[model samples]
Target chain A: MTETQGLHIAVVGATGAVGQQMISTLEQRNLPIKKIIFLSSARSAGTKLTFKGEEIEVQEAKPESFEGIDIALFSAGGSVSKELAPEAVKRGAIVVDNTSAFRMDENVPLVVPEVNEADLKQHNGIIANPNCSTIQMVVALEPIRETYGLSKIVVSTYQAVSGAGAAAINELKEQARDLLDDKEIEPKILPVKGDEKHYQIAFNVIPQIDKFQDNGYTFEEMKMINETKKIMHMNDLPVAATCVRLPVVTGHSESVYIEVEKEGVSAHQIKDLMKTAPGVVLEDEPKQQIYPTPASSVGKNDVFVGRIRKDLDEDRGFHLWVVSDNLLKGAAWNSVQIAESLLKLGLVTVK
Target chain B: MTETQGLHIAVVGATGAVGQQMISTLEQRNLPIKKIIFLSSARSAGTKLTFKGEEIEVQEAKPESFEGIDIALFSAGGSVSKELAPEAVKRGAIVVDNTSAFRMDENVPLVVPEVNEADLKQHNGIIANPNCSTIQMVVALEPIRETYGLSKIVVSTYQAVSGAGAAAINELKEQARDLLDDKEIEPKILPVKGDEKHYQIAFNVIPQIDKFQDNGYTFEEMKMINETKKIMHMNDLPVAATCVRLPVVTGHSESVYIEVEKEGVSAHQIKDLMKTAPGVVLEDEPKQQIYPTPASSVGKNDVFVGRIRKDLDEDRGFHLWVVSDNLLKGAAWNSVQIAESLLKLGLVTVK
Candidate 1:
């Protein structure tokens, strides 16, 4: 391919929720894609999805599927990414992986374009996407961290069921219907699909997300804790997360309490920073009763932040309510943004 | 009335949600009640509610309604309590008010029986029940505070709509039904009914609980912060809260992080502390996928404590998940337990 030609792209797990979003985001974004292919597991193979009004048939993902593909986005599952991400990398395709398989790998660069676009230069053909909860949070906090160094972060997430996947979404809807009908609900896919003990996600909040780690923090919480440190390039930064799944379908909301290194930073100053911050929309107007809710944040690409206030006791501490479409800014849009960043920063050349 | 005979009891706002639970809790508890009267606003005065299998008509609460009453439990709105509580006190009745009106009054004791039962003895005539979210967290944390002094607390709540009122609960049910039917929902009561804007709470979470205070903290958040300090008698303790309303009907769950004054404390030690803590149930077996969820905590009087773990970075900091029925342990049962404490301590006289 010449330098003037559009890059060839492939979307793994194209039939899944974030995969479909990747395709749609790629179609909407100004990324130069010469050709696009959709791939999934054998189970989901033969599925048809639309891209820019064109129906694309999903084929079973294999090593050869990466041939002639310049960029590939993987979101099927961790096992699928672990099995095929290297194959795509071997075929000269840069893979933006949306699983936890290689996030902590020393060689991989976990990129949230707005936060660490420069880190894309360190990618070894495979770029890792941070956890959905971690991506939006870093996007909101990066500007603050740059303006005034960040000291500590404690976040409690009100996450959506969609993060668990399409089956989990279906379970949530079905359970809601059954619950409203006053019928018995047998939860099959929630908290974690592969883990034991599925809890009802309709009309209830489950404190467990992903599987519990030996340290009592769930894998999801650990991801948020670890990913933030890595993506922000601050390994010693104190970060803690309590990830809980809410009944919401799309957006993930976070109640973030942060301590900045600088003293006497007013909430108004932080609000001003968020207003001019990249990819962050300031929705904080308490008197007007205007704040971002998960329902209002659906299908949005930008992270919504509001409820910015200084901690009552600690002058260096501040509280913010950050929200974004979990499937978009958290997953698909983030991966696609990485691809766009690669092109924008000349990290990947077409020639 | 004599001490040998049962004491006269009156329940104000008997037609409301917490009032109804108060009646039921009174029936089940060992508190001696020789006479019981139900009272409400004039509009709900004639509503008939069953207590101890006997139908009691709610009368319009007036100064004369508390005549000869020894103990009066009030769950009416703040305005009603401010207007009638002193009247009840004048008639020789001690008031356990489940409203925000008297909670911050320095002269009135804000009692969470598990944490501050002894404070009941200091009540001049009116006692205040703590906010639903505050009551549950303090119950789970008081043991730790007693064992190792607490220095700081930060809590993010997954609160139920029932904390708003019976109308908010109905709104949640109706919105769920409407949303399940793919119908549009216009939320009228949620976050706060008196608040200007109403957001959908069916599949959504509202970060603002009550009205937003001038300091950018919601009234509910302020109540949790202030009331926790008052109940624990830690006037200078640093407490912060982000109170969010969930779609759940009854139970309120909190993600609480606290820093104890003493160091070298392990999560296991805290878990052990919770196992025997008064009004706290330890469900911290992560391997068994057992934790306190809003669904599992329904109808229970105790605060369900689990996911108790030390912060990964802060040696003095520990995290906990606490859940309890907002109507039972959070409001009605707490008020009744305070009355029982008053009786047990002989703070109230039947002579």
Candidate 2:
């Protein structure tokens, strides 16, 4: 196939929540795709999804499914990615894995296009997408870090339920409805979906996100800490994160406190940098009462940053509120953007 | 009247959210009271409320309302407290002001009974209850500080809408219903109820809890920062806060990062301290997926502390998850406890 003929794109887990978003994002994005294929797990296979006004049939993803696929986007789960990602790569497919399976892999380059697109060039067949919370944060901080220099980061996330999967979203909705109706809620999915104890998310905040590691940080918090360092290429940046799941269903909001290397950096200067930063929207205007909220950031692709303020006692420290659609910018849109970057950077070739 | 006759008690803003909680807390506590009077602004006056199986009519609160009141709890708005708190104090009542009006007053002691009940003895007449967010954090950290000594504190709050007031709770409920029904939401209250712009709180997180100050910190955030230093009686403590309002209706949650003066203090030691700390319930067992959450903390009068872990890079820094009912331990219960402390300390006397 000629370069002008575009490339074949396959979306693994196309029947899932983030997968549907990947299809929609692919349709909306200016990616040159000659063919689009939808693939899901055997349980969800045979489902039909729409792509660019055409109904696409989803087949069970397998090793053979990656044949002739130029780029494959995977978000099924870590197990699926661990099993099939290597298979796809073996078949010459450029895989953009949106799971934690390969995020910390030394051979894999975790790409948040705006923050580390050039890192995509070093990809060895598979590119890892950073965690949803890390994607929005790194995008917002990259500009500030680039200008002010960076030393440390402490983030507390007010994350949405959709990050846990579509089932968790349904649990949030049903639980909320049951609560409003004064019915007893049976929580089967939340915090850690497969954990022994499930807590009600209706009008609640769960401090645990993902399972706890031996170090006492949840896997989600570790992802934010580790993946951020990997993407920023700062191994010793001194990052700490506290990840919490809120009742919100879509956008993920983070309260990030970062210490810059430069002294005497003002919040006004940081806001000015964010205004022109790629894939970043500066939404701070205290007098006008303008700032980003999860509901307002829903369906948006750009990371919204606001509430910029210097730390009260630390002149080099600044705080930011970063928000984005967890399904879009955090997962699907970021995955699709990685594919676009691969094509732009000549990391993917049409066969 | 004999000292054994007990003291008359008055609850200002009786018809409001926190005021109702104050009445309930008073009924539950074994405080010696000759009579309980409910009072509100003229707008909310005449509302009927039940306390200890008896219905009481709310009267228009005036200076005369505190004529013989031994303890008066004020939680109306800042303006109401500003106008009536002094009035209550002048008429022989030891006022427990819940609004921000008198919190910073040199003559008024900002008291969190669990942290600084002794400060209650220094109250000129008005004893200020710290902000809900500040109250919970100080309760959780005071124990640690007593053992290890604290040098710095950085907190990010996931506060409930009820902290904004009764109308804000209504807004959250209505907005949730509207969103669930696929109807357009009109947010009339939240962040700051009477602010120029109102944002939807249903399935959303608003970073601004109160009106933004000139320094870009919200009044709620400033309270957490300033009151923390005062309540802990540390004049040179480095404190920074980022307070955000969540859609939860009752409990407020905080992700706090604190640095202890002593090195080699493990998270296990902190958990052990919290397990025995007064008014603190430790719910931290990562293996059991146990942690304090807002929903679980509702209706409880103690600060629930969990998710205790060491900062990845800062050996002296530890992180904690603190949750408490915004109206209970954060406001009304704290007020009632302060009043109890007053009687225990002989700060209040019947004449």
Which candidate number has the best TM-score?
A: 1
Candidate 2 vs. true structure, TM-score: 0.97
Expressed as tens digits, the lDDT of each residue in B1-351 for candidate 2 is 112678888999888889889988888888877788899989988888887787888999998888988899888888988898888888888888989898888888999888888888777888899889999899999989999999989899999988888788888888888788889877787778678888888898888878889888888888888999988989889999989988898999899999999999999999999989999999998988888998888899999999999888998989999999999999999999998999999998754
List, residue by residue over B1-351, the lDDT tens digit for candidate 1: 112578899999898999989988988887877789999999999888887777778899999999999999999999999999999999899999999998999999999877888888788999999989989989888988999999999999999988888899899999988988899888888877887889999999898888988999989999999999999999999999998989999899999999999989999899899889999889989998999899998988988988899999999999999999999999999999998898889897655
State the fnat of candidate 1 relative to the true structure: 0.84
- Backbone clashes for every candidate come to 0, 0
lDDT of 1 at A180: 82
- Per-model CA lDDT versus the true structure: 0.91, 0.89
The most accurate candidate by lDDT is 1
Fraction of true contacts retained by every candidate, in order, equals 0.84, 0.86
Total clashing pairs in model 2: 0
DockQ of each: 0.86, 0.86
Q: Write the per-residue lDDT of candidate 2 for residues A172-202, one digit (tens) a residue.
A: 8888888887899888988777888889998
Cα error, residue B177 of model 2, in Å, equals 1.4
Model 1, span A1-351: residue lDDT tens? 112578888999999899888888988888876678999999999988887777778999999999988899999999999999999999999999999999999899999999989988988999999999999999999999999999999999999999988899889999988988899999999989889898888989999999999899999999999999999999999999999999999999999999999999999999999999999999999998889999999999999999999999999999999999999999999999998889888887664
